[model samples]
Target chain A: MDNLQTEIRQLIIDALDLEDMTAEDIDPAAPLFGDGLGLDSIDALELGVALRKRYQVRLDGDDPSVKRHFHSVNTLVELVRQHSERTA
Target chain B: MDALASGRPRLHRMTHEKPDGVTTRNTTLIESRGLTPPIAPGRMDSFSLPLAAWAAWPTHAPGCAAPTDSPPPPGAVDIAFVDPMLRRRLGPVARMALNVAHRCLGERTGVPMVFASRHGELARTLAMLHDLAAGEEVSPAAFSLSVHNAAAGVFSIARHDTAPATAIAAGDETLGMALVEARARLSEAHPQLLLVCADAPAPELYQDDITTTESAHALALLFDLHQSRRLHVARHASSGTPSNSMMSLPLADLLAGHRPDAAWSGTHARWEWTLDDA
Candidate 1:
């Protein structure tokens, strides 16, 4: 869990060009959009593309599960781990 | 303002001061309050204000030169920036509108205003053509957004600004078209008008015909002048060597670089000038 958190945090920073951010600055449970990382709707779309390209996870705009999966670094890592494990 | 001809509209030709590498031309009106919504450094997406506000959170090396003026007006305003990356993904209409809108309303919410983009949204139009080529249905959203005035619609919704909105898409004469409308609206008692004119680099298909680079430029004209201030317009050619005419410079340049003592009025199309506010 710890390792995955670190990896995902780095990915978010790299993908979004969060120039001032380091992995440690990201909170596991904090929101990504408004307060936590200060991302916006367009960032959400870019992140969606990054997730698919990196993890081979297919996302649909209509899927309600995407909300939970994208809640934060911790949730995203857990979701990625669960999906990867099931596929493996 | 006087009509030279009685019955028909008099044609006006715009003359631009040629810039070294840039091919677009524009003139702007700056009110006493500074350009409304004072654009901040690195704040690219003032129309997509979220991108601008988020980008301006003091992280990256500061982008544009710092404003010599005071801090931006307060509010949770919607803004967007035209960082090269995002600009590459947008269509011409979107590109032009976003550029102009950002210039006008980056961070402050004042009276409701109008947005004018001559080319409107060209990317959507290109996509519609591509869909027709592929025997696929043109996306309704794309079709609607393709309209010349769609940028104004998006600008309005993005800002949650319900003030009277007008969008004008006049072919090569977009600036003249929009200016006429702006003048009419002002006559009808509208206090302020935000006039924006932007055009994108010609697309690949049209490249052979029009060789302009992905030219993207916008200007904000704040028409609300205090009674003490007067805008003057007269037909005259520039006497000095034209240095920065063809290219679009940042709003700050137009505010500071031009002769402040001489009030200027000119339309962007032919880049003609009628010195006003002298």
Candidate 2:
């Protein structure tokens, strides 16, 4: 679980060109948009594509339950882990 | 800059051309009417700040004379900005466009606008391909966010603006198609139209056609009903230069050094000025 989270966190940092930030800077409880990380909608879209490719999980927009999936890097890693296990 | 002596080829130059059935020949390329933004490179960091932002945000618009220190009350119009740093990390397509829209508004409040991106959400596209290859489940949020009009829609959100917007992709003729829609919108109620054309570098797999990587920039035009300056659009007979090649002549050739004794000729749009002050 720690390894997966580390890998995903690095992916986000590299993918978004977080410039001055390290994965450590991204709090698991912090929001992705607005004051938390200042990512706009485009970032969300690009991040979405990255997650799909790396985890083999398809994110569905119509599912309101998906909100919890992106609540933070921690939440995302957990979701990906659970889904990957279920599918396996 | 040397006239003909030290000529280095420009990466891209717009040329004029006349296709069959395209009769118009004398149209102006761009209208430089509004409070002209300074050409200085350092100050205007965000390629995409709105007119009010240009007028109001002295720290952003380079060389702008500071507005009298009083803060002006907000109005119906709003400005949206996307700086190059964000673009390099995020998506360059929309960032290029938002730049032109920012310039077109100049000092006035720009009307609600529609922005078009021929290749939208490029970063997402690449990431999606990577995910597929890895056999991982794609993030649902990424898939939903990768739509073509996502940039313009995001800009609308950034400005807290509910103004109507449109996103389009029309191949190599993206600019021409965007102009057609902009003119149509002008026929409606909006007094000024902010039309932007933006495209990022093609991902390696898709590079066979869209060959630009240095970021084809955007040109924003503020359309005014009573404004004196006007750019008439027309197709011109080709100067024999191939359409696929970028500009054949350097801008320095046009500025003062190589001012053509006669009319300048190319395969793209040209700017012609007619002011009463003359």
lDDT of 2 by residue, B129-180 (tens): 7988998656555565577766666555445556677776555435444554
Per model, kept true contacts as a fraction are 0.00, 0.28
Listed per prediction, chain B TM-scores read 0.53, 0.53
In CAPRI terms, where does candidate 2 land? incorrect
DockQ measured for candidate 2: 0.21
Q: What TM-score results for chain B when candidate 2 is compared with the true chain B?
A: 0.53
Span of ten consecutive residues with least summed lDDT in model 1 chain B: B45-54
TM-score of each: 0.50, 0.52
Those runs of model 2 whose alpha carbons end farther than 4 Å from true positions after fitting are A1-8, A11-19, A29-88, B1-89, B106-110, B114-147, B168-173, B200-215, B236-241, B244-278
Candidate 1 residue runs with Cα over 4 Å from true position: A1-3, A17-19, A60-64, B1-109, B117-171, B187-189, B199-206, B211-216, B225-271
